[model samples]
Target: KATMGVIERNGTYEQLGSITTPTLIVVGDEDAATPYSKSERMHFAIKSSKFAVIKRAGHTATVEEPEQVNTVISKFLECCV
Candidate 1:
């Protein structure tokens, strides 16, 4: 099921703008699972989106830099409210 979803993910870039809510997109500077470039593209597509890059981290950025990820998330939530 997960593989199928990955192979055929729903939604399109044209629909991204429909998301009016403020969005926080965090990705590692060296994320291999999903490259940071993809996240940057998403930030560009979403008008209300903010992007953050976790330096010296990879796909598991949250695990590799829990404190940094938490801090970023906290700041995003604070600004969102």
Candidate 2:
């Protein structure tokens, strides 16, 4: 919680936008901690990034939707490789 506050205060939008590597930003549709919209913004900031939304999941998306998460990650990695 404290770390989140510190990071929020010291937002690194500049560094985020400077990423040259391919990035996959995945978020659960029902995630209250870090909503999909926030991830969407990050996807836009990254030049080579793919954004994925896991349905019927929350903050712990990997736990709640393991298969879906794995599938998304697999697809992203396939493109990367």
Candidate 3:
């Protein structure tokens, strides 16, 4: 399910950035694919966006550091609310 969901191309990055909706980007310091730099670029491109980095994790930081990732998500969601 996750693979299918991830594979589906909802839209191009530019289109996603063009959206007025707020965006939150979280990346691990060691991510290889969709690296932190890419997330940084995404955040910069989106007018209203926030970005965070997990200190010691890779691509699947949410799984590698659930508590830290949750913390970032919680904080970001709070800002949205």
Candidate 4:
């Protein structure tokens, strides 16, 4: 659950706020590992970004609610394009 290594190696967090790409930040309401607030911060930092919260799920929302996750991802992709 620790992304610090990846972030440091890739320098992902260094320029996070500068990224202008269409970003979809998805988080689970019950995600204790990463937490929803961390996802919210990313969404806020990115200029062109969308955020989604899946209920009744933990860190793995895509697995917990496939249909809901797909719908949200589809809608976000559509909107971005």
Estimate, for each residue in 1-81, the C-alpha lDDT of model 3 and write its tens digit.
988887995857767657778788899999998897788988888888889999899999988999999999999989898
- Clash counts per candidate, in order, are 0, 0, 0, 0
Candidate topping lDDT: 2
Ranking by lDDT: 2, 1, 3, 4
Tens digit per residue, CA lDDT, model 2, 1-81:
998787779668778988988899999999998898888999999998999999999999999999999999999999998
Q: Give the C-alpha lDDT of model 3.
A: 0.87
Q: After superposition, how far is residue 36 of candidate 2 from its true place, in Å?
A: 1.6
Whole-model lDDT, model 1: 0.89
Per-residue alpha-carbon lDDT of candidate 4 for residues 1-81, written as tens digits (9 for 90 to 100): 367766557535557888988999989899997798888888888987999999888989999988889999999989988
lDDT of 4 at 31: 97
- Please give, for residues 1-81, the per-residue lDDT of candidate 1 as tens digits: 999898899768788878999999899998998798888888999997999999888989999998889999999999998
Using alpha carbons, what is the TM-score of model 4?
0.82
* C-alpha root-mean-square deviation, each candidate: 1.5, 2.0, 3.1, 3.1
What candidate 2 gets wrong by more than 4 Å, as runs, is 1-9
lDDT of 1 at 25: 88
- The candidate 3 region of ten consecutive residues with least summed lDDT is 9-18
| Candidate 1 TM-score, true structure as reference | 0.86
Model 4's C-alpha root-mean-square deviation from the true structure amounts to 3.1
Q: After superposition, how far is residue 69 of candidate 3 from its true place, in Å?
A: 0.4
